[model samples]
Target: MSQYGAKYKYGKASPSDGFDCSGLIFWAYGKHGITVPRHTAAQSKAGKWVAARNARQGDIVVFRIGRRLHTGLVADKGRFLHAPSSGGYVRMESLSGVYWKNKIVGYRRIV
Candidate 1:
């Protein structure tokens, strides 16, 4: 939540520099001494997969919009937080929304 409204910075992770999708996830987990990959490709495969309907808060939410992979942290049953895109900011998005629902790859729990 601290990162909410932080502008997106491709490939960067810290709050000062802003964050890309997976970078947010990387830094967040690392903050608690839990190591997670810093890129979507690796991140999508690092943990055991879980069905989205059963995903709990803090689960890694994975999505593949066409060939571009995006990752974020689940904030609730149907909402997640992430740095959405190039000009976007970190924000909570609904998993059940049409924009995201079709793109969802699944969910993963790393800790």
Candidate 2:
């Protein structure tokens, strides 16, 4: 939660520096001693796949943007937390938006 509003820095995964999409996942889980893969693709396959309806809070949410993948942690009903892109800040975004809704790949639970 502390990362909210932090600057987005590609290839970083810490509150002091900033975070990218998957970087937030890496740091958030690491704070609890969980070892999650450090990149979007690997992290997307890091845990048991769960249907969207069954996906609980904290599940890894994956979405395909063009040929690349993006990731974030599931938030409220239709939102997810992430550091969107360079120059963007960490924040919660609606998953139901036309762009995001169309890009969803799946959800995964690390625990």
lDDT of 2 at 80: 89
* 3-88: candidate 2 lDDT, tens digit per residue: 88999999999989999999999999999999999999999899999998997789999999999999999987799899999889
Estimate the lDDT of model 1.
Answer: 0.91
Model 1 stretches astray by more than 4 angstroms:
none
Per-residue error for 106 in candidate 1, Å, reads: 0.6
- For each candidate, the alpha-carbon lDDT, in order, equals 0.91, 0.93
In candidate 2, position 68 carries an lDDT of 94
Q: What is the lDDT of candidate 2?
A: 0.93
lDDT of 1 at 5: 94
Which 10-residue window in model 2 sums to the lowest lDDT?
A: 74-83
Per-candidate clashes, comma-separated: 0, 0
